[model samples]
Target chain A: MAEIMSLSEAVTANVNDGDTVALEGFTHLIPFAAGHEIIRQGRKDLTLVRMTPDVVYDQLIGAGCARKLVFSWGGNPGVGSLHRFRDAVEHDWPSALEIEEHSHAGMAARYVAGASGLPFGVLRGYVGTDLPKHTDTIAAITCPFTGEQLTAVPALRPDVTVIHAQQADRHGNVGLWGIRGVQKEAVMSAQRSIVTVEEIVDELNPRVTVMLPSWVVTAVAEVPSGAHPSYAHGYYERDNAFYQAWEDISRERDSFDAWIDRHIRNTRDFSEHLALVREEGVVMA
Target chain B: MTATLDPPSTKATTDEIMTVVAARELKDGVVCFVGIGLPSTAANLARHMHAPNAVLIYESGTIGAKPTRPPLSIGDGELADTADCVVSVPEIFSYWLQAGRVDVGFLGAAQLDRYGNINTTVVGDYDHPKVRLPGAGGAPEIAASAKQTFLLLRQTPRAFVEQLDFRTSVGNAEGGSSRSSLGMTGAGPAVVITDIGVLRPDPQTGEFVLTALHPGRTVDEAVAATGWPLRVSDDLTVTGPPTAEEISALRALTGA
Candidate 1:
């Protein structure tokens, strides 16, 4: 059975230093609240994983929480480069960061393989590609049935997997919809999982794309607007303005630190963060 | 730059021409594994134009995403609401993409070689890159699995290189028999639609050669812009300017 806890409690209880963690979301339902809580707790030397690491990951990297990032793509969406990520790589302002990059397909397969309790995932990829040159995890294996050579990457079994969803029932069965990335697989692949939901209801509407039964989930935290900036399917719209604003906020070291200090470090929870954003008159939507 | 003897009927940007040229290549009802940005614009334009039934597959697991506007990124939630089906990411790659269900795979590149192999990984040294571009997303699998692939990029000496800094996606591997010997079933990079012209691989050599030029561009200019000793078609054809209908539909889709 899964326990219902506060976001801080969930992060404090679940996430630890030097753990391999995956905060999975495609472009929507990103676990920003959970990431903020992890930052608030100041967990260091963590390995962070995601398909696309945007503003949230940049913030975490800037705050000196992550020692490594395993991702396919890292950018600021329609805006531009992630300055903090660039700084960490180029100048090592906060710390020297390591990266293990993979394609979206590769990461997807690895997650699936991990969920299935397999040792590695296979795909018809990385042939004549430079990804194999940089990443040691990728290797070639011939298929047993067809004898065709295929690329293989080891299954990603994270220590803790965090995801944000639309809702969860009283029984701790979480439901999520819209641009469903590898949330389900990530949750199942990790040894421990934390799901931050917008609300807890008696009966979760059956329109969800995928659902996780109570037994597989470790903890469910009710953090409304958990996926702000990144939208929840039914709860809110994507804050394009914030995404646009983040370019400036994340560009310079001083501004980035100041913004994180004002918004995340100063706030206790997501609600307080939203209040700060509102008070600062930074339009969200 | 030599001025064209006959200008295009309507005012259109180079990016617009590139999109139209790429859009025309997509056939009706064909499933395209589309990358976000330029590919998405072209695919959506195709859906709004001649290929009304064309399907757009995004890596975010949205199959047949019919967005009202061009999505900002692959993970845009609007893609899901407007899509016909949304599956898990693993299912999207394993079942749909690697299963060889995709018909046309559209991609853009930071760098490309004469053989149409792409390099989105790095610009300089692999360990210490001069410019670190976004690494391969799904391009490697799309290049290997799709029945055919279409490359959309702004042609430049820097991008269209003799040799890539890193090959992130294979076009024809090295040359003829290379892809086949490697057991890659898909015909890699059938068409490369650039800002100035269209290039297709030589049947025997698998080298991308300029087959057609857009209305305002010249063959000599195209050759000059390419880093390799680009070959021109013996009987080069000029691609017709974007039709008003195509332009109107593109404008409607993009709202630009």
Candidate 2:
């Protein structure tokens, strides 16, 4: 019995300051917009964790909210910059930042181990290089069966897992159109979860049967233009103009906040930016 | 391993320096967690050149792989068929990566900052990011836990940057020794390879210092392309461009 709530309310309720949270999507796909609202809600001293965080991560960390941030690698050349992330390093921000050296699959695999409640998930990502000596969190352990060595990654359970999808029913049956990796595992590994969707449909709808059969979802929030800025594989066209603008803002560390304040923070409706894109249609070079 | 031995030069276009600079980091018997693209190409070269026995592990269960050519991603069959062993993702991490057994972790970056934090996230706001990247695959652990991480990239203001949009992976963040404080005793990033030259982390600051530049390149050019005030080693030297033989070997191996 999941109650439908506003995208913002659901996010504010589930996410708090400094809580270990996992957001759905790979780079740019189905990340919960409501999650961003949660960050904008002004929770501070949080430890943000992800495989590779992009603009959403940048905005949150830049806003001085993150206390300790952990992940693999990040970048966006010819358009955006990691100014706040770099400043946190060059000047050393109040937050403690840890850079785990592994691929996106490696991190997701760790989450899979976490969801399974295993002590540590064995992985095969970095075998020959120096990536192993960086930390003992994910260390190489001996295989009792094969007597061969392997890389063991510890399981991850976040405080909250926020996700967005194509559709969901009143009972919180999620329909993931096309998500990469084990996103479901990430949600299961969380203590609590929130989901946003485009439309509320009947559980017996044809779309549900073809795409997702809702059984493990908790709640659903409908956000029409939610994935507006981020194109949905085949749903809409990719926006390049917005990317260029973001590139400009991200490059200027000092002024980035002002830019975020003007565009991201200033707007009340998340759909406002969608209108800009619709009118301009993504400006491609 | 010996830089002085000049291999015969091969004639080709598309600027082979990026491939050559990346290939120079390989060492025999060393474990390398290789990401696809340029990093994979370089790791393969290491196997063919000096480190014929270098063990390569991909996310898709391949270990000690000697691929004929670089695959698009780790899932490519070349990694598994050519590998000496193929283990599950979790088993590999538990047995090799997390236990601190790997030697070199190779990676590619979309955005990087001064502290060595990387980003593979969006370019704008969270609710509405501009461009979404391909996301991280296994870079988090590879960047943090490897004995040392090597970043292969083309030198440019665009690639080398002041900061990242998101911290996708952690790499000696905060400072050089702070990783140790966080209970990380693994060797941090030892070197970063680019088209121009090679950069090493300073012992104390953990910030990257320019150690070598290409034959016709200048220190100013390297500095100009950096995202921050670039650091230089006390004994910097000009690196010789790849010889004709090295290029031929690289191309023939790549089948490009």
Q: State which candidate has the highest lDDT.
A: 1
lDDT of 2 by residue, A1-285 (tens): 455888677767777777887765543344636645765577777767665565667777777777766565454322434666765644554354544445555576778877788877775444433345544566767789986666777887888877666677666767653223345676778777777676676762443312333444455678764654444433443343555566667766667877566545665656654454456544431
Docking quality band of candidate 1, CAPRI definitions: medium
TM-score of every candidate relative to the true structure: 0.96, 0.57
lDDT of each: 0.89, 0.64
Candidate 1 lDDT tens digits, B1-256: 2223234535788889999999999999999999978899999998887898998999889998889899887878789888899998899988998888999999999998888899887788876767777677788889988999999999999999988998888889899878877677688899999999999999999999899999979988998899999999897899989877777677778886
Query: Clash pairs of candidate 1?
Result: none
**In every candidate, how many clashes are there?**
0, 107
Model 1: interface root-mean-square deviation in Å: 1.3
Q: Which fraction of the native contacts appears in each prediction?
A: 0.73, 0.12
RMSD of 2: 10.8
Candidate 2: CAPRI quality band: incorrect
Q: Which parts of model 2 have CA positions greater than 4 angstroms off?
A: A77-81, A93-105, A125-136, A203-215, A276-285, B1-256
Interface RMSD of each: 1.3, 10.1
True contacts kept of 2: 0.12
